[model samples]
Target: MTPYPRWTLRTEHTGYTVRLSPDGPWAELDAWGPHGAEHGPSALDWSHRTHFITPADAAPAEYLPYGIRPFTGAELIAAGPDGERGSWWEFDGAQETGTGLRLAFTDGLLGLRTVLCYETVPGTDIVLRWTEFTASRELRLERLDSAAVTVPVTAGARLTYLTGQWSQEFQRTQLHLTRGTFTMGSIQGVPGHAYAPWLAVQDTTGEDAPAYGVALEWSGNWHITAEAEPGGAVRVRAGRVPHEGAVRLAPGERLTTPRLACAFSADGLDGLSRVWHRYERRLSGERLHRPRKVLYNSWEATGFGVEAAGQLELARAAAGIGAELFVVDDGWFTGRADDTGGLGDWHPDPAAFPDGFDRFVADVRALGLDFGLWVEPEAVSPGSRLHTEHPDWVYRVDGRPARLVRHQLLLDLGRTDVQDFVIATLDRLLDTYAIDYLKWDMNRPPTERGRPSAGPADLDAEHVAGYLRVLDHLRAAHPGVTVEGCAGGGGRVEHATIARTDVVWPSDNTAPLDRLAIQHGFLHAHAPHVMSSWVTDAPGVFDPRPRSLAFRFVNAMCGVLGIGADLRAWTPAQRAEAAGWIARYKEVRDVVHLGEARLLGTPADPTCGVQYDADGRTVVAALSTGRLDGAPLVPGRPARLRLRALDPAARYRDTASGTTYSGAHLLHYGLPFAWSADHDADLVVLTRE
Candidate 1:
């Protein structure tokens, strides 16, 4: 009898089954499309399991740790002070949970323990895995990886992933799997925009072929690796980079690795993305269903020229276009005329605001808008009085000049003083005023990362932990305030930090045409509501492509919409058009933020667009970078846009046209072209009647 029966786990339309041998272990597993099964693994179908393993290797023999059995990645790995490394692991037992299963492994001699976890949701193909390590005695843990799992794949699978630089993030790369290790990561003190913490392996049949993807839920210093064996087996490992200090654990203490989420999709990359979207909603975005306020920021309008009178005027214009939150970004603090100085001093610039935030906050509130402010708590400008008084606060090595980016040095959040300082500053501001939101910005990566003042330590982990600590204290003290995370335009975007903040400033480049591609790439792993996109008057800083105001509004409306335009400079017609768009967006905001989304085609594709469908409601934003030329598009007519996720038997109505049609016809044919002009686009909102 099989020691471990087929433990089958199924989501809405996907299934994964695994079995174990008493002497060997739980090794063989399969991820396939939706199917039913009996209670036990033996009672179900194990007939096709032999197809994946080689014919010769399929025959069962005596259990042995040899190459012939197959090289599956270890679910757990640990070491003890007694030098007991990888030799012995006794399988204690297993149990099942509502979502998934748990297994136990122990090293008797070293008194080391490991608990392996696997979790799943009812409607997602993602299987979550993480491990916990504990010891009865003090153990010097040298290596602990969040994920090391071997997946069965077709003979020739292709690897697809994201990699790029600042201003140009999430460039997709598709490559054939080779018989070697392919690894990527960042130890740059934070998750750099150069490489995202996600990857995938897909069968090469076509775009619709079965595929799998993996993601690490960490914001600081992460790495991912794909190792393809010569025999067509592949093992992927991902987690926090272990380049420096060993995670030393004391007796009776425990350490938990980050969560590694792996998902399977028979419908290909698009399916994989939707699975992640579901998983993201399950984990983060608590207030996501809450109406996201249409905010107006003072950064682009006034920059370092921020003053009470100017911001009050901007707030009126913002309220003119139905902005709910009016934010005073940068230049409100002591001596902060520009990025050159006055960072750590978290006080109102007396010259700029004769009376602190009181009168200004009242005036903005009187305009029927919530107020927000920009802050960089983890940095201190060298020319400021804060640095002159507390020079030891910034990150520095002994006797070396602190490396400066944007002419400011990063404060060592790892220090107790720094942590307390941040908490106190935020408490003071929140306790003092009617501030409703915060724009937390980190403009530079860590330079001289070592905090010499602190003793031997992993500064990266400490900095992040301390940063979160500050945010936590603030949240506990003031639950009313919301936060938007920005690391010089989406640099620190990851599951960990994202889980804590209310939103992410995806990019500083607000150019509508360029954002179509950037926002397209963003939806692959993150939810649309968390990505805060702004409609701007400025050209795309990277591509500099000129576009229309309607084009800009529709692009930004794809996510948590914001208007960063210099509203004071807009003509009356533009303001009226903008007001119309804002009101229209408000009507469908629920569907866009809390909806199930899919990319009709990729961002890189010429005719790519985005679709959101929720509970029989659908919205399609069709984008045209150039004219949708050469396709069967009728000139001067609306482009034919299709809708998904409608009941087949039901009739649907286009709210704009008041015309009803069968769901089948809409899916088969589509709506007609309604383009304003070249490089402009359209949004269609439809629902079942």
Candidate 2:
């Protein structure tokens, strides 16, 4: 390893090495497992580097673009006031910061300043990269990427990403990354659920280990691109999808792109994700000193026919089954029966609750559960009084027909009046009711994002800022309130939103089977603690998959547990079983919420599981995909489940069997649990001594 002009950033297990080269700069990696770093590459050569590419026709005195540098996808791009053709930047220098490094480059001719920064936490392999640009004079920027890294991988590497629609989010598929640009993005005001803001590049020539990933933190329009160059080099770029579709810079103006966090793992995709999870836990403080409360929502049980008496019956049932949080979902507000009407109206329906919401909330609280209500504050149905009164409150062009999705028009949250109305409505509700939670949902994406009032203002960026302000303001106003985010589903599950909300509703299709793939994809970039999964009834609103109550409860137990099933329709036996499951979840809820997760297999596999370990406690959940997959069918017999993140010298005992095993045996040899061909699931809990 070189001493000067070259540095290596390290965690206990991984290290990122960067060195200044004749061509520019290049980064090497050590992704070997936590205890092994000598097996990784020491340094990458400059001839294959992926740094900023300068203009092809730069002066001899200027920093010449690397001969092998890419033609496109540079981190900085700009045009001067006189319309310069190309940019030639000179490397100012690099500084070593405690957390990471900052490399400065400037285009003096155009008066643009660019800083490339890198950061890594002590216990995480995530090396966060971001770009900051400042203009000394008036200049226009065409492209300003947050992160652009070129890492050489084995030929025929496979790329995996998540994509889906409204009801279904976080679908997964893998394909060979050939020679071309594979871009997945959304210019739709919000980061649409069509594609997630993360990607993983795996060398298909070997196992899934030693893969690389990149993710952006912005909640607004964003994109992740993976390009396989002709010379077997794979480059990835991620950041905001340009400003207002394009950004214009004035003198003294500055812009910083969203921070792009990346990770490299030698232990497989699971290892890569664990690093991200730890980083998130550091971002969001420890889970509330306690387990996530068992929540029971009144959506599937009583959709739009909710009344005080009906809700009370459901609340009684939910509390009987040991639910700690009771949430009344949509349809309690004025003029709301379905998605067609009544969005902006936040107050309770006087006709549905004759005792006004006060008595209803009080009755629910009397059942020993914190109360929550659902609201879509960013949308307004045309048939609602809110839309009838303020016709111009919705986002639309001067003379264009307002586009409606889910029978709702997008609210021009960019406007001060619209923002004030939302804050006042929610503030009044929080003041009036004894509510503990609010399911903040935006059921549709922003369409016709043009604000008539502001004329040509960039509502895309302003709306996102407004949304963040409302959340922050509400929390500051009522610190006790908890908000669960839902944009149709997992549309808004980015770092920006996750940092502000308590939990996220991953998907509306709560069919136990379908959720496995969705939850698997989601946990790659997000920690499991905030993944709000529900155990809805079979033949769900979308999927017709059938699963046993035990299977369903255990499936939902993978994250924050919520019950949306119709408990009234269940038999006495089912109710008793549900009660038992809820109790078991509470016993080990902290493990699921805060423990490090190591998923054993891919989502396409028939036999897969996730193991969680923290302190001296360990919990492993094994799930079956119903089909045998040609393996030996051993009903009720669990295969050997391996474990990770345990103290090797410690001795562990199973609470249920009273059987003791050394940590070596439990981890290397494994433990046995049983699963059937019909989506059977079992949880193995062990304590160390």
Candidate 3:
């Protein structure tokens, strides 16, 4: 297969040049001055044009939807060494429409300045940002700070169009409106509403395709700006604003809007955020909640069968290992002997231990480890007493029953009674249990659509409001306990969710190699407190050596550290190694977790993948995942590496290998080392001495 040409800027109008960089998937359209302007009788006529077909066999097939829309007319704008400036086209889409665009360039890359001038009727604009960039596609749209402004809106308008690949085949199109703060109300035939601004069009074929739409009709106005940076981050900001409707775009006339997209190879979330921060400073606030020290969870070792004795043993083990917290997961709840039972019953099961619940809590505290409990609060098994009593509490269609997962059904969070029950239950647990943390688990999605007897709006309000209310109640009732949100793992790990909770469970698939990719994807815009586990998984699971342990530990250091395996079963040597690494991690935890991180290299290269903290301390973990095979014990010289974010004047030492090197030598000459034939590796932690 031929490689796609990298986009660049050209002086000739007829010649097309596209530039693909971390900053943008930018394109330049330069034509000589004194060009003819295309005019039409009606605005609608000018707006009509053929839509581009997104290639079907796009690799990383996930990144599809690529296209361009030209304006109805072009005018002889101007010509100079800087570049040509003209109003080529205008568009008044769902949100604010653009009136004209000014184009200029330095070197060859075209910088397009879009002017937005349209009125929103009745409602207001709340959040607006130009978003263009995918994990795979080479597209770039940067936001220019000098030319951006946040304006008020006072109107309601709609922009509808067919987007996505299926739009042409199924005639399905995504719809958007700008009546207020942009929110997705509902899709064509979907019965539910969306709080976010975007919606996916699902129809494969039919007239209903165009019915899939989004709306900007929230209660308030939002400030919006889209900026492209030199790096790959496309900065989109939507600030709160008051309502106003001074400018309106009539039908057939196009208003210009600023939006861009870019593509890049696999740089994790840290790389993504760096690119964004380089251009926009609004996201630089200190994280709202700080994370705790390392923790150990009793899931793999004891499972759900753990009772008071097992719990106490685990707590002791945790304390011995210097783990800050001990979490007892799954089996402690009332009537829950295993995964399939007592899901909805929040009370502690009496049969699991003869002692009362308070005694168990006291025992855990006696071990000098903070206590945490797992609760799948949003679900209940059919046999659960709560399910038996309030059959109406679970979401269901007119007559169909929601299928069971792990023999459980998701509670209808939209119901006020359900919300009240959850709040009351959690409030009681915190007051009674002396708990320091709670793992909030949601294990299922919306499987059915049904309106409350009260109304649909109430249902919509409850979905989001219920979760927020739970957060509020948790904070109010148990000020000391941190709530970690988990959706059968990473499903609920988004910006909106992060605002309400502490850490996010990055993923359940915690194989060391896999986690490098997983945590990389998650950290782009998320805080490092996103939780990752050190557990044994296959491919390397059955290995008799510490290779698996080493792999898991390396991955866990990238995020919050929690052991998912049973420490009681670990050999003495393994335990010693684990404790040593945990202590080492604690030394640099604050610097990496709270500091500004820079990715010095990519994981694709063997000698790559170095990360630096805000204070200039660096942690470089290089592994030959493929090169480690049966071979002679020949050591290779380590490659000299350039440090990206370092204090040029600071002296440093390697914490692990006890090697001392100056910042200058480290930055200029890199490090020297050779890989052992046995796949020997190092977690070289550098700190100022």
Worst 10 residues of 3 by lDDT: 57-66
TM-score result, candidate 3: 0.62
Q: Give per-residue CA lDDT, model 3, range 25-95, as digits (tens).
A: 22211111111211212111111122442112111110111122122111112122233332222221222
- Please name the candidate that would achieve the greatest TM-score relative to the true structure: 2
TM-score of each: 0.89, 0.90, 0.62
Best-fitting candidate, scored by lDDT = 2
**Candidate 3's error at 443, in angstroms?**
1.1
| CA-lDDT, candidates in order | 0.74, 0.76, 0.48
> What are the runs in model 3 whose C-alpha is more than 4 Å off?
1-271, 275-291, 452-461, 535-546, 607-610, 621-624, 629-635, 639-642, 647-651, 656-658, 662-664, 677-681
How many angstroms is residue 355 displaced in model 2 relative to the true structure, after the best TM-score fit? Answer: 0.8
Ranking of all predicted structures according to lDDT, beginning with the best and ending with the worst: 2, 1, 3
Return the candidate ranking by TM-score, descending. Answer: 2, 1, 3
lDDT against true structure, model 1: 0.74
Candidate 1 residue lDDT tens string, 562-586: 9888999999999999999899889
Displacement of the residue 581 alpha carbon in candidate 1, Å: 0.6
Cα distance off (Å), candidate 3, residue 450: 1.5
Model 3, residue 400: distance off in Å is 2.4
Better model by TM-score: candidate 1 vs candidate 2: 2
